[model samples]
Target: MTSKVYANAVAALFDLRDGISLMSGGFGLCGIPENSIQEIRRQGIKNIHAISNNIGNSGRGLAWLLKQKQISAATCSYVGGNPDLEEQMLAGEVQVTLVPQGTFSERIRAAGMGIRGFYTPAGYGTLVAEGKEERVFDVPCILELPLGADFAIIKAERGDRFGNLWFKETARNFSPLMAMAARVTIVEVEQLVELGEIEPENVHVPGVFVQRIYQGVDYENAIEIPMYAEQ
Candidate 1:
């Protein structure tokens, strides 16, 4: 059997270059591939277009890219916790495409499914409709295009040598869809198990969608919004 494991995040992201579109699988900091994001930072690759649920929180996660000036454009639903990202967007330094949360998810899903576009009423009559195609079915709808990436960086709780992955809790949010939507999918896992260790039914993303896999390091599960237990 061919092994999909890499020595490190740098090696796994060997084919990465400047000015490429990337899909980052995470909802805030929850399921992010922290190692690969750090590798991208260390390599100083610039002019990236990142697609994700959010631009990260504070100075961690994807915010590191924004801080490094590596990301030129961002396609995401939220950026409230990332001051650097908000600053860049407001300063016209980075191009921002803010899609409604549900619509954004569906757009990425459409790419993986090989669908050209779909109609949604999420942005029917607002600024989102300014220069896009619009039609009415039962209600007004806007044509949303599919969102694909050159590569996808995802995180899983467990992965096998051949690339099958299993995510934990809400960490499963955007990963499986992004895995299928990208041309190349790289996964960072906490545990690397032998092949067939994971049962067939529990595999979140099949090995077919993943090109490379590596065990991650120095994971910091940063809480975006901190709420202590009534202390």
Candidate 2:
């Protein structure tokens, strides 16, 4: 089998360009592809359509792109703690689409599953349902279309040359789903192991969904909100 490993994020994202729909896998500041985000900044790719959970929080993760004004639009579930995204949205610098957290995950999952659309009651009879197709089946539900992207950037705890991945704890949030939903999935792993190193049953996302893999360096892994007990 041909190895999917790349030298670094730049090499992995060689085809990345401006105005592409990009999916970033992470929840808040955890499990983000730090290297890839930095490279995108360095490369100065602009007018991006971003898809993620929080779009990063506390001025990290995807917030870096927001700081650079690279992202022109975003589809995400939450934006509370992300001041950069909030400022851009309020200033009309970025187009923001806020979906309910559950609906957001299902939309991405539905894309990967090849489902055209699905109906859910998560966003009904409110701003979310406005103008969207609605139906009544025991309860009112709004139609949500699949959310896919041209490329997806994700991080894994461990991955192999063929791109099989293993994520750590809450970090596993949206990476797998984004991997399956994107046309090309670029993954950065802290540990790049040989094939079969990860147990068959332990693989969270199969190599088939990933196109490129690299061993990352200098991860910040910042805590979004630090807490201490009576310290």
Candidate 3:
């Protein structure tokens, strides 16, 4: 078998081009592919259709791309704390599609599973139902199509040369789903281990879904909101 490892984020994302739909795996600032995102900024790839949760908060993560005006469209569940996205969205700079969180996850999952579409009551009878097919079962339901991307950028706590991955705690959020849905999945890990080092039972995402893997460097891993217990 061929090696799936890359020297760095630039090598992993060498074929990435402008005006492509991109899925970024993260929840707020956690589990984001920091190195890959920085490389995309450096590459100055523009007109990107970005899909992620929150995009980024506090001017970090995907917010860097938004700051560069690289992203032209965004599909996400939340944007409350992301001022960059909010400003762009309100100024008619970036087209924003806000999906219900549950619906968003299902849409991505559907694409990975090869499902064409599914019906859900998530946004029935609201703006979300407009211009879409609606049906009444026990309750009103609206049709949602699968969401797929040309490429996905993911981060993991540990990965092997074969591309097997393991994520930590809440950081595991959307990485696996995005990996499965994208045509090519690029992953950066803090720890690069040998094959079988992670153990079969602990692999969060199987190697088959990932196309490229690299050991990352200089991770800030900034927390969005730091909470402290009162003494």
Per-model TM against the reference: 0.96, 0.97, 0.98
What's the ranking of the predictions by TM-score, best on top?
Answer: 3, 2, 1
State residue 156's C-alpha deviation in candidate 3, in Å.
0.5
**Local accuracy of candidate 2 as per-residue lDDT tens digits, 1-231:** 766889999889999988999999999988999999999999999999999999878999999999999999999999999999999999999999999988989899999999999999997978999899999999989999999999999999999988899999999998999999999999999999999999999999999999999999999888878898995
TM-score of 1: 0.96
Cα lDDT over the full model 1:
0.91
Native-to-model Cα distance after best TM-score fit, residue 222 in candidate 3, in Å: 0.3
Each model's RMSD to truth, in Å? 1.3, 1.1, 0.9
What is the lDDT for 127 in model 1?
Answer: 88
- The alpha-carbon lDDT assigned to residue 120 of candidate 1 equals 92
| Residue-by-residue lDDT tens digits, candidate 3, 92-210 | 99999999999999999999989999999999978888998998889889999999999999999999998899999999998899999999999999999988899999999999999
Number of backbone collisions per candidate, in order?
0, 0, 0
Query: Per-residue lDDT of 1-231 in model 1, one digit per residue for the tens?
Result: 667899889889998999999999998899899999999999989999999988777788889999989999999989887899999999999999999989888988899999999999998899887788999999999999999999999999999988899999999999999999999999999998988889999998889888899999889877778788975
lDDT of each: 0.91, 0.94, 0.94
Kindly report which residue stretches of model 3 are placed more than 4 angstroms away from their true locations once superposed: none
| Model 2: how far residue 118 lies from native, Å | 0.7
Candidate 2, lDDT over the whole model: 0.94
Question: Pairs clashing in candidate 2?
Answer: none
